[model samples]
Target: MSEPTSPESNPHLTLVDHPLVQHKLTLMRAKATSTATFRQLLREISLLLGYEALRTLPLTDTVIETPMQEMKAPVLAGKKLAVVSILRAGNGLLDGILELAPSARVGFVGLYRDEETLKPVQYYCKVPSDLADRPVLALDPMLATGNSSVAAVDLLKEKGAQDIRFLCLLAAPEGVARMKEAHPDVKIVTASLDEKLNEKGYIVPGLGDAGDRMFGTK
Candidate 1:
């Protein structure tokens, strides 16, 4: 595995360079990889990415027994996290993270891009009413242009998501810069940092459209 890259003087971006994550990402990046395999690999890699993203979660001491005597053990502190998915492709990453955080509260925000304008348009959104208090982990598989991502984070902030983190499988430098500039307060976690996006707004050398590849569409 290679060392993770971060922007100069920027602490919000985190590239997950763990060996297992890199291996899974390599498998997913192959064009020959089947949809079933791609989906499975995404799930596996998401788990690894999620582990790193949630590494700094607050912990508290709790009383527990080891079948013999009582002992104080570390447990998650504060309210359960709000895991909000940016719909469609985001669900791929969401499923795996949910496995790791079974007790987290779930939410969904649906947005689609306009091919011509390259802007995000929201179609649907539903989140917890008291989202203001809990930490938020916004899940999305690809961070391409960052328009939809920034839009999604804007909506999350509007709904009172103060401490928010963005998690994705892959990111282009363009998208990372856009997100950093637009929502500097939100941290980004991704498995791989790929090259630039092509003329059509697709990340070059990316795993194709994450949604299409995961679902075997077109």
Candidate 2:
């Protein structure tokens, strides 16, 4: 998520093309990948994506005494980070990120897309306090049509989340464009930006439905 190898127009978007990430993604993408394996791979890849998402977090040096000597150590600064998942499917990514930031303030925004319109419908939303003070990480595995993502971000901003970063495994160019147009200030970190979304509003050349694959529901 550090470089822009794909659509270079959007400065806020990051495509994580590291070899390890790509390797795991390929496995997850295959039609034969099982539910248990897909879940595990999502967890593993999320850890990597989480690493990149929080890469620019501010650090402050604090005095600490080591066994050898007293020294200053760099640690996270400011308010604790707020990790908000766009629920259900988002939980897959959330579990892995929580492992990275165990103490991070967790939140959820439940939004499901309307099948016919591909529009987001809010069912629930509860986020951390002092969102303006924390760096919010809003996550979902797929950024397909971007409607859900934009709606989610709009909700986050309404709750006073000024510093927000979006995390996803796969993104469609349409989704990226919509996010950029809707919230230019937010950064998008993803493993891959696939081709356009399909007629049914699914990311084409995409890894099926992330939630279904992760849960074996479909």
Please report the candidate that would top TM-score against the real structure: 2
Question: How would you encode candidate 2's per-residue C-alpha lDDT over 178-208 as one tens digit per residue?
Answer: 8887898999999999987789999989999
lDDT of 1 by residue, 1-218 (tens): 12323555468888888888988898999999999999999888888898888988889999999998999999999999889989898888887899999999999999999999899999999998787788899999999999999999999999988989999998988888888888888899998778888998998788899999989986
**Clashing residue pairs found in predicted model 1:** none
> Which ranges in model 2 have alpha carbons more than 4 Å from their true place?
1-7
Please identify model 1 stretches exceeding 4 Å from their true place.
Answer: 1-5
Q: What RMSD does each model have against the real structure?
A: 3.4, 2.9
Error of 1 at 3 (Å): 21
lDDT of 1 at 7: 54
